[model samples]
Every structure is written in C-alpha cells, then in structure tokens.
Target chain A: MSTDIAGQAKKMGYKNIKVYLEGEPAWSKAGYPLYASNDFISKGNIVLIDLRSVEKSEAGRIARSVTIPSATLKDKADSIPKKAPVVIYSDSEDEAVSAMKVLKEKGLKKVALVPGNIAGWVKSGGETTSGPVVTTIVWKRQMEKGEVSITDFLKVAEGSATDTVILDVRNQDETTAGMFKNAISIPLDQVGNRKGELPKDKKIYVHCTTGARAGMAAKDLINAGYNAFFLNEDISCKDNTCSVTE
Target chain B: MQKTLIKFIPFLIMASFLTTGCAQTGTTVPQLIPQHGTSGGSRIQDRPYPIFVGNVSNVSNKAKVIAIDVGKGADAKTHLVKFDDKTKGIEYAVVGHASIINYEMRGGEPWATVIKAKLAQLPSGVTEIKTTELKSLLDQGTKFTLVDARPAKRSIEGSLPGAVNIPSDDFKAQANKLPESKDELVVAFCGGPT
Candidate 1:
C-alpha cells in the first residue's frame, strides 16, 4: 500500500521516492515501542494503563484507563489478560518503556505506549479524567450488530427451542463430512429458489463454517419474508456433537 | 403521426408494467438484469454475484470488517462486509479509499469475497528500501524525510522514530507536508505486505 503512495508522489513531480516496504510491523517486532493514536487510545477496545505515580494519576489520567503504577505493575501483571492489547502511559518515556518491557517479559503480547505519554495525548486534543483512579481491570468483548448471541444459537442447536430451525447453508459436499442432526441443509445459491420449502412461522437460524455463507443465506431468507437470523461465529459438528468458539 | 403513436401505445404500456413488476417484487431483480461488465475477467462467470464499486468509508482492523459507501448523496448506502483470511486482496483496503468488491449478501449486508485496489503496481520511479538499510540511515542521522504512508490511527499506534505521517488516502491534500525541495530524498512506508 505504501507503494501506492510513492506512485502518487512520483506523479506530483517529485523525483526522489523510496519505499520502506517492510513498514510498521517490522519496526515494532524489533523491540521498539509504538505510539497509540489518540483515537485508538480513546476508543479502541484495549486496556489503557497509567504507569505514573498515583499522585499524578489523581491529578489527571486518560479516561477509561486503569491505574497500575509502574512500581506495582509486576505484582498485578498476572491479573491482566495476556491476550488483551495493552497501552501504558506515564509522565516519563523511560518509565512507560520499562513498564511495557515488563509486560512483554510476562508474555503479554500487543503492548504499546502512548506517544509522549499523557502529555502527548493532551497535546493531540485528547481528554482526560481526574479523580480516584480505577484499579480493577474490567473488560468485555463487544458483539457486532445483527449477530445472534452464542447462547441463543446453542439453545436452538440443542433442540431446546421448539419454534426455531437450524438452517445449515454449507455445500452438500461439506455437509457429508458432518452436520447437526437438527439442521436442514440448503446450499446458499439454492436458497433463493428453495426458500418456500421452509416454514415461515418458525424462526430460522443460519450457520455455515465461518458464518459468511450463513450471513448471506439469512439475508436472502429475510428478504423472502422469513423470520431469520445468522450466527456470526465459528462452529464445527461431527457425529451429532458440535463445538462453537465465541 | 397520430396513427403511428396509437400503434406503439400498447408496447409502451407493456414496458411500464415490466418495470413496476420488478419494483413490486424487489427480489432477485439484479440477478434478472445483468449489469454491464465494469471489471476485467470473465463477465459471464461473475454474472451471478453483484459487484459494488465504492470508497472504503471505515475499517476495523481488530474486528476484521470494512464498510463501503456504494451510493451517493441522498441515495447513499453503506455496506458492511466481514473479511477473514479467505477474503482475497483484503490487505489493500485502506480507510477513506475506494476498491472493487465482489460480494454476497446476507440479511442485506455484503460479505466480500474478493477486493481489488486500483493502481496496485509500484510506479517506475520509486525505489524500495530494506528494513536494515532504513535502520542504518536513522542511526546515522541521515538527512531525509521519512514518511509513514499508513492511516493516522495506524501511524499513531507506532511508526519509525522521526517519521512524518502522510496517509495514502489523503496524499493529494497532504502532499504539502512533504519537503519543499523536489530533489530532497523522501522515503515512504505503510503496513507492509500483509
């Protein structure tokens, strides 16, 4: 993609254009700290930690950030989920960098620093909150819109829901490997023509390997005046047993 | 002239009914009326799936989803498409840019099967820099402008030290951020080769 930009620069009458094709990931992997954008720091689903003194945090801290002073971070490191993308900031760049290294050593991947720390964030027009800092880490995964909840999908798959039908939209060849006994197979391309075969009164729940095809099938069914929803998740079924990952 | 008009009146009425019939059903009309071939490759093979050409309005890298603006003005509609490892050419989708998407629909949402960016080829004049060479230049205090060509958000997350951001999408408007001397050596990079 950077090459695309170099192309534009060349067209704008610039003679010297060189592309660093390896880009940001390479720089980051080589033990360098990356600066989190104000937007991402403020809005992204990540754990924002303040590694400054508690007094400094009480004076002001980024909103939604948990207070884990760099001095005490080692003891509380186990409490932080390893998978969570962590962003740490402090008044001092060295302090933040060291704290990030601590997390990296603890096997916590995706750790980053706030550029210029809190001062950089403030300079970039980012807002902060001043009060007793939040010490406990609280995080939850947000679901996308139009996705059927995993609990509801599992209920239907288990045959506990009398009025719901599991519509499997995988190809016939795929179904031969394994399929839920309750599911009615209908390849996606044929759904437009065969939708009438399904009962309109029953709620239709759709699924495919990775939910892409199921999503498409659910849309076609909904357009055809059926009460349909799609499970936007990964699922595998064999011998009447299935596993779902949320 | 009146006699000729009267003879054609029945055919005009039939055409009006045909259009209204499609409007009333609003189902599979796009399939019935094949669109003109706008992309390369076999038109007949791609006939079953509708093609959308639009700017990428938003991209959620974490969520692995992108929204494309397929309409204009009052008629504008944004199609949210989910992309996974199977999605072809998805790495080229940058926010606030345009790409050609061949998609399938579910509940009126587009799921992109393939995404293609225009002008993917590197221009003849540009030179490629290796990571080690760029690092040596930074260490040696080389006198050159290092441009981060990724979006502002990505660049902020982490970019090379001393690199100025000039996102590819807004390159034309932000070109002034580059050095004034046309002869000045400028190096650019993005979220590479992913």
Candidate 2:
C-alpha cells in the first residue's frame, strides 16, 4: 500500500512524501477513531460505499452507502467525490483492495479501507444489521498473488514478444493522455458487455493507471473464458517507451 | 487598464499618511536606513497577490544586466542575472542571492530546482530591489510606487510602512500594478534574508 501511494504521488509530481505504515486498518485496530459506521452514515463530506453486489448491499449496509459494485467502479470514477473521504468496504480484504486501486487512479484523496467489512465494524463495537451476509461465489477463475506481480509483468512488457498482449482498462481520457505500444484499451465498464473483443489465444495482461480497474476487468475476461491476469502495478507511457512506476 | 489605475489612485492617496518601515533584504549587509520609519510605518497599499512591495533603489536600462549583492557586510556576494524575453525584463533578484544552491535533502530539493527554473522566467521588466535601498528612498519621500511582495497576512502581521500587499503565489496576473510612468521608480521586496 505504501508503494502504491508513493507510486501515485511520484506520478503526480509530488515531492517529499511520507507514508503511514499499514495505513487506516492498522490505525483503526489501534482504536484510533476509524470513522464508526454510524458516524460515517451522517457525514456530509464523505462518500461511503459498499463495493459489494447490489443484491448484497440491498440485504444490509451502513446507511448512505451508494452501491456501484466492485466490478463497475472503474466507469463511475467521476461519481465518487475527489475531495472527500471515500470509504469502501466489501465481504473480504482483497475485495476492498481492488476498489482502492480504482479510487487511487482517479486521484481521490483520503480514501480508506474500512478496518473490517461491515462484519469487522460489528466486531470492533460498531453497528451493523443482521442480514447474515451473502458472500459472492468465486465461480470464475481468479488471479492468485505472485502469479503476476508488477516486476514480472514489466519484464514481459519490456521483452520483445508479440504473443503477450497488455490490455489497458482505463477510460478514454486516460488512454488518450498516453498508452503503451499496441496495448488494447477496453475500459472496465465495456469489458463485461464487450467480452468478445478480448483476445483468448494470447497471454493477456490487464492494467489500468493503477491496477484496481484492471483487477476487476481481468476477472471479467477470465470468467468469460479468456486467458487474462491483471498486473498489480503502475504503468506510465511516453511515445513508444512504456515504463513502470517505481 | 485605465480603470485599474483609477482604482489604485485612491489607495495611493490614503497611503500618503503612511510611512516607510524596515524590511528584510535577505542579505548580511547592515541596513542602510535606520531612521526612516519614525512613526513605525503606515498601512500598505492594496495590491494583487504574488507582487511585492518596496521602493526602487536602482534602474539601469543602459546596463541591461541584473546585479545582486547577498551575504554579510564584508563577505557580501554580488552576481549578474541575465535578462531575456522570459524574465519580463527584470534586472536582478537582489535578495538572498547565491552562486550555487545546495538545496536541503528533504522534499524542498525539487522545489529548489523548480525555483531555479522559475527565477529564470520571472515576468519581464520586473527587477527586484533590496530592502535597505528602498527604505532609504522612502525616507527621502521619493515619489515611487511601492508594492508588498508578500501575502496580505504577512503585511498585516507588520509590513514595511507604505507598500501595497499582494496575495502570495499569484504574481503574474497582477503585474499591471506597476506604474505606467517608466520614469517613476518602483520596487517590490519581501521576506528578506531567511
């Protein structure tokens, strides 16, 4: 998370940055005012979101949580308040991390992962409703950690191989600013509806400005039976030279 | 443009009662005028942000070169800043002038580089004047336009006697505050020697 924050900062031309260790989850666990669910429901300057399914959110949620679902968050970047604290939660930690990537790419500030999901909030003495919990089944193939870290992805990207394709899932404005040589840009919202355009034969590597959208998009492509995995990395491109963010 | 000058006329009138106060020159040299602000200075004039306040000590179009003197009385350093199309015809920085900058290792190093780049591109004809020299001119009641280069808060906190305060970090948009009379002397100074 520190590397991700530092990477984002460096890309924005910010200097002299210091990263808080383990960030909000650690801070909240230390009992240091983690924006209790009840407190979050009433705040005007905050955009609290449950990054779960509409069906799951309908079952139970902290009041005022707008449901955009984890998969479709990439397309709704502008809907999220850039200046406010964007608190996102899901069934698990990995789900929240995925939503965080999209928020980071949008350059939103004060984004935090809720210490635990709604379940964690209840465990930490916060309030929650009892719809039990409807967990989404991982019927689709998912990318396990270390299968494609940023480092390994970069090696393949820099290598001279026509078989491996880099799929950029960022929006048109982002891709217009810059894009890798021969990278296919099928934005996240369009991927579910436009799954046919994704290549099946190639070793498909997905990415966004940050990896959240790519992570979501990768799951979609893989579920639709395409060879794909999202890179947990930052990518910047200038002309023909596409480089990884440090 | 004429309307803007018309607006400034009233400010200039109200500022007549104000006196010239001392300011930092960002140099080690002893102040040249100590007896100037007997009443401890007056309200600074109304100026836009990022433009400074001070009196012109020197203006040399014939020389067409920037002259800076920074450091202590004896070990004071002098350098010539080149003026071109980008610098808006300024002669010199005239403050905390350094030949080689050794920026602090913290995040300020990038800003030092940015500052170096920006200093090279200051608006044209915008020469900086030292605090002491401007104070000396003010003591003699020299008919010159004064501008407070620092922000409004800095001026309110206690500023040089008769300068106008401009908001900090917003200079280029307010360059019109300079007097129309080329013969009239103008100087802008702020945050000296720090």
Candidate 3:
C-alpha cells in the first residue's frame, strides 16, 4: 500500500514512497494549497463553507467562511450561489466529503472540501471572527510633546489642556475608589456603542488602573481615526503618587 | 388541525413571553468563580474580582459553561471564557487566544466572596467593584506581580516594576523559565485576558 510504502522502501521493499516525498515538498514549496487537517479536502477557487452551529460561531468562526450549520445545510444550500466555488468543512472531513458528494450528485459542479475542516484551519493559523461584528472606530495613540509619562496625563487631568476628553476604560469598580473629576467612565465592553458620546474633535486620553487596557482602547480608537493616547503610567486616587502597585 | 393550532398557539405565546420577558429583565449574571493560582493549575474558588461569568448564552448544560475571567475592575471588561464541556448552551468552544490572567490574591474579601456579593448589588451583566476593596487587598501584602504576557520588546519599554515577561506565544517553549513554585503569586494579563 502507498501508505506504508515509505517504511517498506527504506528497506528496499518498494520505491513507491519516493513519489510521495517528492510531491510533498514540491507542493508546499510551490505554495499549493495545504490542508491543516486531512479531515477536509480543498481545491482551488472554491468557496469555504463553515458547517458549525450558531453558538460556536458566536465565539468565532473561520475567516470568510459562509456559515451554514450542518443540520440546516440541506435547507440552506440553495441560498448559496450555485455557480461559485463551494468548499465545505465541519468538525471533521467526513461531513465535508459527504457534502461534496451530495452536491455533485445533485448535478452541482465546482464543489470541494476544506482540508481538515475548521479545526485544521485553526491549527494552520487561520483567524476567526467573534460575536457580532460591532463597528468601532479605531484610533492610534500619538505621544504628545512632553507627555511621555503618566505624570503628563495627570497634568492634563489638572486643567492643562482645553476641551480635552479623558476616557476611563476601567470598569466602574476601578473608578469607585476615585477617578479624575469630570472624567467619563465607559467600560471597555460598552465603548463600541458609546463612541458616539466621545468628542471626535477633542484630544482624547485613555487610562486604566494600569496602562494595558488603556493602551488597547487607545489603539482601537486610533484605528477608528481618532486622536487618542494611552496614559503610559499608573495613576490612582489611593495617593497623589502616579505610580501603581505591582 | 384547527384544534391543534389552537392548542399550540398558547404554548407558542407562552414561549414567546418567556423569551421576550427574560430579555427585558436582562441577562442573568453568571456566578463568578475565582481561581487562586496560575492558569494551568487554577482551581475555581468561591471568589470574585479575578473571575466573572458574563455573556451567558446558554445555561442548560452546567458542564458546557463557558465562563471567563476578564481581569480586575482596574482593567477593561474584555471577553475571556473558560469552557467546561458539560455547560449548557455551549454548542461550540473557542479557546481564547489571549493568555489567561494569572491572578495573585490581594486579600480583601477574597475575590470569590466579593464577586458574588458585588454581582448581587450591581445591575445584571455589570460587575463594578469599589476601589476600596482593591486597595484593602493591596494593603494586605497580597502583593501582585503583573507578568507582561507580551514579547521582550514590549515588556522592556513599559512594564510594571518587577513584572516578569512571559509572552503567551512563547509560554510553551519557555515554560521552564517560570518559577517551579506554584505558590508564588503571579498575575498574568494579556489583551484584557483575551
């Protein structure tokens, strides 16, 4: 059998395994499509269809996969464009192969299976989308002149800038001890919806107890084309000292 | 057929009422369970701040529970879920790519108790803890080591003093660099606990 031929041929039983070795590197080197798992088969120019349930899809799903849960695929198959490339995937390749056979039997052409299914795709570094694609304008942080430290953010809080927006990305509990006076508190989860409340024209500064969350929120705002900066140091109401406890 | 339709209509109405009414009342806050140790050996305790169960998409299967620990109130409430296969309503599982938050106990009311109490006081789906609790914990010498779960480059420029760098991507290959003593307090955070 070709499967065990390589081992047998090592002892000069047969040379059929040589062909597989030759083809393996060539395929990868030439940038031919590689399946992360043998569960799904893939062909060029095929639409990748994810056959995962909705709950699983919510956490995330294969990138660009047109999701149609396997249980509902029969009824929804018609919703897909018939002439386009069709590649199906599920938890395993069996379902994809079955889907391909059924589609072919139904006189549909241009159908294939994703290699190794969704699991394989994940193993191969494919990305998936999480939950509803809530739109949030992303903004990047630009350190201002002489504003490299948390102390700078503190200065801005103490009436240093005109019409500046201080956005506290920390959760309510964090602000309970004491947030800067007149600062707007918006939990990161709600930032996507509350972006409208922020002044796009004003210089915005984001802060958390530590700088990580503030930095992330700042990046998101930056990607959204807003002028935002993350406070680089920890500033707390516990004491006048801007340094945070490690 | 008419009788069946009539019989089913009330049930459908009741079902609709249950669904919509529940939605109006708002999502139930899943019980938060804090873990005392690192992500690998973290055992769920009856504590709060470090662990929170939000986005209760399903509650039918307790084994299928997908609860997440976003981080302390000082950080953003980012989505992070740890899966238990028997949990209800979890038809799929996603291992969060973000590194798990390694929380070191900062005393106070013990994170588990505080979380349960706070969840009751706060609005559903909202867990806002007062800073006093955190400060109290901090005062107890329940010191925390904020491990930067990013690369060396990011950790060097801006890192919590004495904070160790343990990039999640390199965790497996470089797990040896970590302390063998599991009892040592360490808090690992990456991208809001991802």
Candidate 4:
C-alpha cells in the first residue's frame, strides 16, 4: 500500500509526500497517535498548531499550539520554527494539508500532518486540555441571563405548574425510548415546521438529555415571542420523572 | 367586359398578395455554437466532493490532485481537493462541494493534504469526528464553538468541547442568536448516527 503512494507522488511529479490513514476507524483500530490541531507539544521537539478560527482557539486549544488559521497561513508563515518537527492537524484534513504547504513555503522542512484530525486522536485515547463547556448560542444567552437551573426545571415538572410547558428538543428517536412525561417532543430540526403546535400562552421550559439542546430551544422560544427557560444540567427522565432537585 | 375583367383580375391579385403576405412564418433556425464550452457560463461544479490536490514524495512535479473521501470508507465519489505546493504549502479551492478542511501551516506551500466534507454530506448527524481529542486544543486558548443540536438537557456534560447547546427543535427560531459573523467558527452536532 505504501509503495503505490510513493509512485502516485512521483506520477504527480512531486517529492516529499506525507501520508495520513484515510478513515478514523481504521486509524483507531490500528492504534496510532492522534492529537488536536492545537494539541500541546510541550515535549518531543514537536510544535502543534491549531488551524481553527481565532474564536475556536480562544474557547480552547492545545497547549502551545499557535493560532495559525489555514486562511492566514501565507501571511503568517515566518512565525513557524524551521528546526522543530511540526505536526499539523484539524477537523478538516483539507485545511490541514493546505496549512502544511504554507509552512513548507516558509522554509520549515520537518513537518507532517496527523492521520485523523483531533477527533480521531480523542477517539484513539489521547489526553488533552480542559476548559469551559461550550453552550449553544441560545444556551449562551440563557447563561448570560441567569435564569433557571436544571434542578429548577425539574422542580416545576414535579410540582405540575399548570402554566409551564416542558419542551423536549431532542429528535423523535430519542424521545421514543422515553422522556419526561410532562415534556412534549419537538426536535431541533423540526421546530420551524411545528411552531404552531407549541403553546404561546404557556411559559415554556425546555430540556434534552443534556442542557445544550434545551438551552437552544429555550433561546428559540424566547426569540419567537415565547418566554422560556432551560435546564442547566442533564437529567435522565427514565425510571422516575427527573426533577430539578434530582 | 374587358374593363370589368381587368378590374376583377386586379382585385383577385391584390387579395392573393394580402393572403400570401399575411401568412406567419413558423420555422426555427439553428443558433451559432458557443465560442467556448463555458465562456460566460459556470463550469460544471466539481462533482459533489472537493478535489484534493497536493504533492507526493520523491516526485518532481508541480502538484498532484486526488479525490478525497466524503465519509468513512464511503468511496471517492465526492472528494474535496487539496492543492499541495512546495512554495505555497497547501491551498484549497473555495467553491468545492466539500467544506474547507483546515490543517497546520508550515511555510510557502503545503506538501501533505487532507479534506473535509460538506456539512450536509457529513457521514451522519452524530458523527463526532473530533470529540475524543479536541478538549485540550480548546484549553490552549483556541476559542471555537461546538454546538450540540441535541436538547439542552442532553448536553450538560460529555460534550466534545465546550459545546454550545442548540436544540434542533428551536434552531430556526434561535438562528438569529447564532453568530452573525462568518469569522466565528460554529460546528453543530446531534445524537444521531454520525
């Protein structure tokens, strides 16, 4: 398999080809080193670079992985080190390969790309940095507003507030297995279609297995002229009705 | 008689002229061939995938182009292209079927290559490509938003990154709340078969 790769490179009339295994499963089952684009390269004379946008990098990135977005590589080529072994990775291999070329042009000789992207690395059991959880734009908004905890939502459900509406934004398949008895399922993708089904008079409380979808739903309801809240925590509606306190 | 006959003949000829001249033409003529295959017209888009163009090892060529895989072992029907140039490193085409894949940059051009599929074409709704390893990258001050399209409750923990919660149910009503700027990187995920 490797033999043809070199030949293919030669046929394309190029030298210095770096190889990446095609798929994540294959790479994982085979057991390989995978890391995020911004994976911390504190040791091994390796420099990890995060090619995601500045916003993503700000949220979290590998330790020491510089922010060199794929789009800005040409302008920022001089920053990379020539002596160190560099490994490029991203969720998108297309971006990773593009960045690799930018670096080579800057005269960095020792460079390679990760087989699978950061996701592949994690699936393959690699360690990484910890940071704040990302919330949906709606969740982010709710978090900013400081209203209702997961526990609070549960309390309302358990108490049977007549005016409250518990909306489950998970897909139908998820709801089929069982969900909060008081909750009505309206999947995220289908919300627009079923807008009429939702009650405008009710103060809606939204949720999902985790809080992200519920946050988004609550945000949507608020945007659509309905007052809504989200559960800050993930609640399992199985065995017993999940309450905010639980 | 001769005078009347001549007057009648004139009238007959005039009527014949009117009848023949008033008839509508209904035939279509072939138009000229276009000068170029797509002069003003758009190039037939690269098949659903972006083509990956890059350099291979030991070859003294400009750049080699390859079709990238859209999904896991899904075949090369819709591959995104990556261009690997020694001088430019790697640069991808903006108008391909696949989404722009990002990687680390070295110098002038990129030598190696990778590709990403379009969001709609991603293997499944729940394909968590970067879940296992993106956490630390997030820690490095790389700010990115991972969106859980699941309901808020399902995504309280075990998210790939500090993922935002966007319920698919309310995505449209809340689309306005999403980042309006293109510069903001947003990724959406669901708990489906990805």
Which number leads on DockQ?
Answer: 1
Model 4: runs farther than 4 Å from truth? A1-147, A243-246, B1-194
TM-scores of the candidates are 0.55, 0.26, 0.27, 0.28
Per-residue CA lDDT of model 4 for A1-246, tens digit only, reads 111222222233333222121222233222222232323333334666678777776666554466677787787666554444667667797788667666766887555565466666666566555454222111011243524765567666766888887888776766777777777788764554566788899888877665655655565466567777777565665454553321
Worst 10 residues of 3 chain A by lDDT: A15-24
Ranking by TM-score: 1, 4, 3, 2
The global Cα lDDT (0 to 1) of model 1 is: 0.71
DockQ of each: 0.27, 0.02, 0.01, 0.02
lDDT of 4 by residue, B1-194 (tens): 33433443343333222211001101100000121122343322221121222111111122232222222121212221224553232232222222223333334222234443212222111122453344354457555555555444333322233445555455556455444453454444443211
lDDT of 3 by residue, A36-139 (tens): 22222222334566777767766777655666777766766665545444656778666665665565555554554454567766786666677752222122
TM-score of predicted chain B, candidate 1: 0.46
Q: Can you give the lDDT of residue B65 in candidate 1?
A: 62
DockQ (0 to 1) for model 1: 0.27
Better of 1 and 4 by DockQ: 1
lDDT of 1 by residue, B23-50 (tens): 1112222322322223333543444455
Clashing pairs in 1: A35-B156, A35-B157, A215-B106, A216-B106, A219-B106, A219-B107
Q: Write the per-residue lDDT of candidate 1 for residues A14-127, one digit (tens) a residue.
A: 899898766676776666777766677898888999998889999999999999998899999998876677889999988998898899899987788887889988898889
Chain A TM-score vs. truth, each candidate: 0.63, 0.42, 0.38, 0.40
Which candidate should be chosen as best, given lDDT against the real structure?
1
